[model samples]
Target: MSEETPVLSLPLIQPSQAQKHVTHNEALMRLDALVQAVVLTRDSISPPSDPDAGECHIVPSAATGVWSGQDHALAYFDGTAWQFLAARPGWRVYVLSDLQTVFWDGSAWTGETASFQNLNGVGIGTNSDSTNRLAVSSEASLLSHDGAGHQLKINKSAAADTASLLFQTGWSGRAEMGTAGDDAFAIKVSADGAAWHTALSFDPGTGLATGDAVQTSATDTSAGRLMRADFGYGPGNVLGAVSESAGVPTGAVIERASTVNGDYIRFADGTQICQFNASLSYISAGLCSAVWTFPAGFVSGSTPQVQGTLNSDSLAASAPSVTVAGLTGMTISGLGATSVTLNVNALASASFGSGESVDLGVLAIGRWY
Candidate 1:
């Protein structure tokens, strides 16, 4: 009836009451070895040849020697013999040999590091919650480094597989940049996820960029060239004139006729303009005539202005009333969009005499858009 009696089982009465202390002391010794005991091993059937006192082990099936027929029992070495304690569910034991914590779960003992199920959150060196399921709030995070320069790779199943990092808004993709379906590095954007536009791409083989209608190779057919800004300027500032270069000239002024389809390059000073020029020769047995065709066709609804000087090779004794007849002898008899005609004769006299040749230096001013 004393407190030294076993909690679960009472010792049998011996022949003498004086030896009750022996039974009580034995039960207390077993309780001291089993309570909060650290076992050296589990499922060990064979007894150690040299077990230290107070060392414990979980009895295995078909155990031999003192542990025989005591499977799943906590066995303790009390230096003289083995003491057994029945294991129940939720009993925990620390294995000193393996430095692991193990517990009995109704059926069997399992290690603490084994896989778990239905965990809400897990944190390493911190506490986690439902929002952050697996949070590791640390200064730096590392992955797959085994003592050398390491590369973090995101591999796909095949060559035509898409492997990219997509930035999303509300779980919808906005932009993606990576090797999507190819080896070339590409950056693509999308307003809606269904249709995507490639903004830029860099070819790994050629080291060239292709986008924005810019040519990537020197042998391309189009006459496209790179344009670079001279410098940055403030807003609302007027740009200076650019000199003529391999491309179109900057600060160029153009003028179109009001009544015609003629466009011309008009300069700032208006001193020089683009014009058509021609020289005509005429044989004079009567009124000499010649026609000039424009090199570039003139614009419709425009009449070209013609001016010239005429030279006559004839001087005769029977000269006309006007001795100097050549200066005032030429006239623009006809004019059209594409051609002009000039008439040459002796001024206020008969037609130019036989064997006289007339030369006219003519100029036409007009526009052909």
Candidate 2:
């Protein structure tokens, strides 16, 4: 009942039509132009001055000249003039100039991309080289995940090879981190890319670290090195060693250890004290004397500060001096580095002074080392 097809609007011949060949030929012309449609371009707004017969293009927006008011329509040229055909939603056409296939989605033409499941290389805006197969010249790149999490992993086949991320400045490596060599986790840096210095490294087997950042030796007093407990002094072994260098002690910060030398106690700081108790016998009615041998402290031929105290209870006399008794103090004489002599003279109650005996305590302080 209608004059043309509903979808393509091609002229339809009706029964009893006078010139059926004219209408049928017109339908055939429409088929020749639209089927397997191919176009020179999809973005040109101006009609070509010398378009050949059967030359086609998708008229762009703001079209001028003969293509005016035919935006987004397929413009096909016949031998005589140009014809504008309304496009459907799913019409696909190959664009020769862009070397791509595009589809009509009602308003404009969009690229018709094929599946890229197993492409050998994909260079977005640059040429793909053999080594860098998927090269892209971009300001930034993003590899995000579908929803939750994402990870970018790099792997290597052998331990001797590197698997790491390198940071660079001006295409020269400045730092690198990860397992670099021999299965060890390492962080290395370089001012110049050729020579690398390991700032931090971890041994995979023992989990111990070794690098310029760690302090592994005992005598490392340099700056910017971490002090290890076993390799340096700490609370457990504060008195690590004893050395007086440049008239200043280098080790043993406090008094935690001491050396015993017979009656002498020697300290790590070079201080020694000699403490002893002695018994004296009277040689005369008012005199008593005792010989003392020095302990191992107090360097040879050194005089030390000496002090003595007598046991007061022993000075009492049973003779009672016929009523009460008294005695004078003691004296130190014949002093030497290794020995000393002490004498006590008692003048009170001479009758009871003879054979008098008493106990004495002595102390001496000096340096040992």
Candidate 3:
């Protein structure tokens, strides 16, 4: 048998030897230093001069006085002098100064949490709650990266389920920015923690955003809102029929009517332009007139501007090369909201065109309201 223990190396009492009680007492003194050890400190370089009995310390490197040469060993005062036991791997002690348990992990003393895996419901500086699972009460917390980068992600179970980060003041919710109440990302705010306002939200597919604080219609002049584009347009929107009372656009940007008699084009700014065609006979010599009724009337009280040009059918080398277009004067008369009369003065010479196909293209501009 060995003279000392194989584990703790406690001195064994010699067989049939005198002073066996001294060896047994030495072993008991080593036991008193270990076994649920509570160390004063692990930074002591020397033994204390007035240490109490059974007081233990971890002797550091290059220990001075009575602890000289006993580096990294557990030292305890045994009433007369100090006793030491060499430290080993897996040796544990509760440090009074740090108020934590440390263990010698074959290389150095490390905190009990130096290596841990798969621990859940672990609270730091607070208690973990049922729903929270891992609650923390602190002024601030840090989650640093191991080498290059870090990402904090919150996932949800379904599209309708909420996955969000809520900010609170005095246990009352104040603001939040995350995918809340749905898969879309949203930012919501609350003044009294009871009523909430969705300040912004984004679509998952199109990445478009919509909110009450955003300017929707193109003509919206409200302040304190972000300018935004409408999600839908065309005939259902700015291209639709004119409706001044509609809150979207004041009226259609542009509207057109293709009629057999009169073709008209209307603009949003209340301007309407219409066209008409006329074929007059030159058999009536001096002043011939034709009245054209507009396909659409202008806003009453507004007289439309009328102008026309004659595209003569037969220009068989007429006299007076200066008036080659057959007619001397074309003027507008009796202008009104819905119709106007075009007067033409035929040439005095008998160079009358035989056909009534004296086509005249006329245009009128006025307000359509």
**Candidate 3 minimal-lDDT segment of 10 residues:** 313-322
User: How much lDDT does candidate 3 score?
Assistant: 0.76
Against the hidden reference, what TM-scores do the models get?
0.37, 0.46, 0.61
**lDDT string, candidate 1, 1-369, tens digits:** 444334434354466578788777677667676577689888678988888888889887888987888888888887788878777677788988778988888777788876667788889889888876776869987787689778867788876898888887887999999899898888888898878877778898986767543444423335543321222122322233322233333333333221131222333222112233333333554555667665445567677676766433333332232245443556886687777777665654445554444555566676443
Question: Considering TM-score, where higher is better, how would the candidates rank from best to worst?
Answer: 3, 2, 1
Question: After TM-score superposition, what is the CA distance of residue 131 in candidate 3 from its true location, in Å?
Answer: 0.4
User: Could you tell which candidate, 1 or 3, scores higher by lDDT?
Assistant: 3
Model 3, residue 113: displacement in angstroms? 2.5
| CA error at residue 49 for candidate 2, angstroms | 29
lDDT of 2 by residue, 155-228 (tens): 99998898998988998999999997778999999999989988888889988888987775666777887776
Model 1 whole-model lDDT (C-alpha atoms): 0.63
lDDT string for model 3 (201-304, tens) is 99989998887677777776677878654422355556645544443446467778867667888777688899977754443545456788888889899988
Q: Tell me the whole-model lDDT of each prediction, alpha carbons only.
A: 0.63, 0.76, 0.76
Best-to-worst order by lDDT is 3, 2, 1
Tell me the lDDT of model 3 at 199.
84
